[model samples]
Target chain A: MSNHAFIVYKKEIKDMVRDRRMLIAAFGFALLMPVMMGVLYLVSKDSEAEARNTMLALSNIHQAPGLVAFMEKREIDVVEFEGNIVPEELPGKADALLFLPDNYGEMIKQGKVVIGRLYVDENTKLGIQRGREIGSAMDAYSSYVAGIRLLARGVPAAVASPIITSSYDLGNAGFFRQFMGNMILMMMLMAPFVGGLVVAVDTLAGERERHSMQPLLAQPVTARSVILGKLAMVSTFSIVSSLLSVTTLLIAISFIPAGTLPFAVYVNAHTVPLIFIQLIPFSILIAATQLFISIQVKSYKEGQSYISMFMMVPMFVSYLKIFGGEKLADFALFAPILAEMESLGSLFFTGEVSVSHMTSSILVSIIGILVLTWFTSRKLQSEVMLDAA
Target chain B: MIIVKDVAKAYGDVQAVKSVSFHADDAKITTLLGANGSGKTTTLRAISGLLHMDAGSVTVDGMIVADDPVKAQASLGVFPDSFGLYTRLTTREHLAYFGEFHGLSGTKLDAAITEVDKMLNLSEILDRRTEGFSQGQRMKVALARAILHRPSNIVLDEPTRGLDVMNIRLLRTILFDLRKEGRCVLLSSHVMAEVSALSDHVVMMAEGVVCAEGSPAELIARAGEVNLEEAFVKLTGQEDNGERKVA
Candidate 1:
């Protein structure tokens, strides 16, 4: 490195360390990941435990004997309530209240039946969903009773029920992984916004505010060296932050109980390394994007706002993929944050690795860095530096 | 020596500096005297390669400033009116950082630091961070960094703009010593007394153009005034009522 470039880098690092806010921000990010994940893990575990221990109340009025028998077999306490059940006690005393309305059996016999209402607290959506599962069991018992009654009348149950439909998920393990990978994808996408913003704002806008940019620009160093030095410092912070975040997430996952669901939370050792390998290019893209934004803005506050606005890009992309049911196209896998999200989803849910996808991601990040460097260099060469000075 | 040949700087349609030219030879303190918006700082910035000129060229040590900015910058040291010091760096670190930028290191860097420290009288606060330093101390530190490489050309824009009488005298004595070392010093200030006391050559500017150029005595004689201040007012076409105070 040139002496001027080395001095610039050393000074920047010194300033970053000395500034309490920067240190707090960098360390705070690292601290935030572990602490946040730990808290979330504990809260989730507590909630699951609470749910499992909860007792539910089932009320079947004019109910078929078979449905009643099934409830008894399942050990669900049947409470015969004529009027509205106590709303406040539903959450604490009962997980959910099952309400079987009048003439339910007659309606089933007529071959046209209405499902009973599952009374639950609106705030407890999870409890309501669980109540529906119990309701489905009751429906199965009702159907069995009606089928036996039809057989006794010399009419085939198949004749009465002419149409039958069933559904199955055709997607492989990769698709399942992608579904569960949303959270990781979202976090990985956020890496650029979080890491780049801090580095860029401190490197360019902060220097301008401090009135040190003039002397820095007046040095005999090339503009490229100046920018690269700044990018290296900021990228170091970002990469460290990303690694810490991923580690914290992994630690949190380790606390999850085995056999909690169909999928495993424990990532394979190889998977962890692969995710980190993919993150390298993603972090570079983030740092470059942030540096570009930081150099364009005149103040740290403006840089912060720009970063916040850019943060929305990843969030929007994730939402579009999830709720919008948008399939990830091959081309989308090359778009910076989008690529990381898709790659993370693949890695976590299916344990699948796409070398082509990884290569494309690397190329995209390189292009992003090049474009950002060009514009930043042009800005450095312009009168903007003088005005900033 | 530093030479500016017909330099003009324009920002959009507004010309900040208009075809102004002058030269500062070694062993002389040349002062650029002008009113507000008179393009004195613009001229200094152009010489420092901080601003690009629309026409003509600036040469320091026979190297064109705009064409070979790095070489020209290496040969010159610029000290603006307001010196900005890094709050996180100590006085010694600040000097060392700039010394490294000028390609001085190891024993040479240490010797340069020692020389600038003694010259600027900053040895007492060498280890202290500059966050709590007084304005005079900051100015001294800035001067120390600028002269660490001992460049042949020194450009100062209002170096004593804000200073106590004692500090101002101290800075003037330092500038006198710098001049004795056969270094070309380009100074810009509105203070008539300071300019008259220190400047060997005076270039008066008005509306971004050189209105008059000569020695302090020559300008005074040419303008038919008793001192350089009245001469500045006369050359720039300002009414001189003789009521302006000189500190």
Candidate 2:
């Protein structure tokens, strides 16, 4: 940095340090968000484990003693459900509710099909797993009765059910692991934006609102120096916030028992630094984009409106990659946020670097920083900047 | 010396300054005397290289502001119409911040700060944050910020707008001292008494045009008027008590 730019940077840092609110917003989100998300991951993992050992409330258990025995064999503790129904928020006490018909016994005796109802809230990973386990158990019981009926008529079991199907998962990770991986990447990608937003708004737009832009611009320093200095200050917040998130997340990951988390997070000596290397330029890129947005507006409130919208780029792009990634083309991976997600996603989940994706991400970030900072500097030179909003 | 030649500026549809031309010489106090909306601020901004004139040129110390603004700006100290200050920064820090841009730092910057502090009588408020400073205090800090680098030329856009009588007197004295030091001091104001008392040369502007230019007494005599205010009213063709024209 030029001495003039450094001077501006130093002054801006001093100015920002005194704003207790901006410091709190920048640091608090950086330091706390990763830990909170880590705790959430642990809880989700626990819920998945709990789903395997969940209890089933089967209504009319007396009428279906055979089904009760089969559920117990599957290691599910089945209990009677009398005058009860599942609420929308599935209670943790019972993972699933299986309703049996009052005439279950009579229907079986008369060789008529018996109707039953199973209630499960499939909102959470735990609920989905619980529903699958209970449904599989009930299906097994039904098959058992069908096999016995075939034997009584001297029809071989193979004749009645010739093709017994079984499943072998070809995918490496489970549904829960993929979802967790997507979310972790999403959170990591969002860290810089959340970290630098308040400070960036306060620096440019807030300076204008305070009417300090006039005097600053009137100085002998060029607009380029002023913007370069401000960009560095904002990037300090961005990079610090993002690195803290990674650090805390790594710390949180250490608490989990080995091999319990579905995806491997290869956070070792080599990759840890690489993760930082990948994130630093990305953070600066985000800071530059924010400064560009900030210079367009004349007040903090106005700048925030635009910058907050820019923040949604990462989130919306992450969600698009998570839920609808397959529908997107391969080149879309080279798109802004998607490229970052692809590169960082590989580093975090698979402990490998996709060099093409990573390089493109970094190159694009550097170029973006140059372009944005240039545009912002040019904008700062406008005569309109002489006045405040 | 500072020079503005046929400077014309417009804000979109509104023509703010049609044509303004003046010369402010060194070792003299020149005041741009005009009413509100007379484009004094616009012309001052143009000279400070803060605005782009649609027509004409402004030069500070023989350097064209439009061609090389940073060089021109280095020769000029500008106090804008508003006292735009960062409330979170101390008065000394503000001085350092602006002073550093002019290539002042370390002991040099400190020395400049000390110099301005004494000149502006800013001892008591130098270390305090300007968050809740009164108008007088803000004016002092702002003036100190503008002149800390000791530019050869100074341009102030109504520097005494909201100051108390004592602060105004202090500001006038500072202008006098700067002029004595051989620095060209150009200021704008709508107040007639301030213009008559302080201006060694007066450039009377109305509707963005220079209606007349001379010593205050010379202008009164040239317009055949009793005082500077009536000279302004007659020369600019404004009514008794308004910026609007009599016709």
Candidate 3:
């Protein structure tokens, strides 16, 4: 770095540190974002687990002993329903309600259909999934009875059921797990952006609004030196906030009960350092991008508007990786934010090294910083700079 | 010493400064006297290497501003049209920041600040943030920031605009002292009495061009007027404008 650039860097850092608003903005994202997301993950995980643990309240249970026994064998805890005939909501601990008629057994023995209604809450996704599972189990019991009836009639049961198929989930992660997992990665990537945003806008656009750019540019320093100094200052905030976010999340993860999070988190010492290593240059790249955006506008408010818009780039890329990652080609998936997610996902959940993705992220980050810094520095010399509003 | 040879600049289709030319020699106070919108600020900015001239060149201490702005800027200390103080920084800190840009640091930097503080009576606000500083205190810091590096040429645009009478007198003394040290001092203002009192040579600008130039007495004599203000009105033909302020 040039001496002039270093001087600018030091002054900007000191200036930023003394600003209470900047400090709050920088630390707030680092401290609160991860904890909030972690809490959300825990809630989703518990709800999913609750959905899987089926509890059914069966009405007229005495007339359906075989059905009740079948449900108990299938691990659906069955309880007697004694109060309201038609409850608006599920009874205290029941995931669903199974209604049976008084002549249910008699109809079965007479070979007539026994009609019943299964009321399951469809308010939440978890509710819908639980309802589907309960309906599937009831259908299985009905098929079992028909097979038995067929065998007693001297007809081959195999004739009734020609195809035999079973299912096994290929992936261990559940629906809520995958969603929260993608969310966590997005939060981690966004932490640095939120951290540096205030400082980035203030450094260039704020200076211009204050008309300080005129005096600073009047000095002997080159625009390159001035921009480099600002870029370094913004990167300082970005790196600190991002690293703090990772560390806070690591500590938060350590405190959670084992196997509680819906998704896997492999935050050991090795992966933690690797995650930091990936983020340092990536945070710098984000800093350059933000500074580049901030310089295009002439006022602090205007710069904030543009830089906030630039923030959407990360969010858009993160969402693409989360939802469309599988459908996206490898080249698209290995872009900046996507590449970072791919590497961090492994370091975070799978405990496998994604070296190619990591290398690509770092290389792309370096190239991006250089290109953005070049453009931003050139913009500093534009004639409009001389006549700020 | 600074020289502007037929410098021209424009914004869009509107010409801000057109074919302006002048010389500021060492050991002399040369003031650009003009009415508002007379392009004084643009001329000062061109000398400071802050703008790219459309048609001509600016050279400070034998270095061309357009060809090598840094070298040209190193030889010039500029007080821009606005004080542009950083409200978060102290007077001393502001001095150090601009001082460092000029390659001043450590004991040398400290000595420069101490010296400037003594000259500008900045001891009271040296360590205080500039957030609530009075106009006079802000002017002191801005002037100190400009001259801390001891450049060969000092250029100020309306430096005394918001200062009280006392601060203006103090600034006048400093400009005279700088001239005594053989530094070229170029400044712009329309206050007739101030221009008459401070300038050894005056370049009168009207509508982006030099309307008149010479010593105050010489211009007054040339325009067949009794006072410098009368000479200004008769020379620039600003008699019909409502914005002329001779005071």
Estimate TM-scores for all models.
Answer: 0.89, 0.93, 0.96
Q: Residue by residue across B164-206, what tens digits does model 1's lDDT show? A: 9989999999899999999999999889999999999999988
**Cα miss at A222, model 3 (Å)?**
0.6
Best by TM-score: 3
Model 1, residue pairs in steric clash:
A177-A349
How far out, in Å, is residue A10 in model 2?
A: 0.9
DockQ of every candidate: 0.61, 0.82, 0.82
Name the candidate, 1 or 3, with the larger TM-score value.
3
Candidate 1: TM-score of chain A is 0.81
Off by over 4 Å in 1: A1-3, A37-56, A60-65, A72-96, A100-125, A154-180, A260-269, A325-330, B240-247
Which one wins by DockQ: 1 or 2? 2
Q: How do the candidates score on chain B by TM-score?
A: 0.95, 0.97, 0.96
Whole-model lDDT values for every prediction:
0.76, 0.88, 0.88
Please tell me what DockQ candidate 1 reaches: 0.61
Candidate 3 chain A, run of 10 with poorest lDDT: A44-53
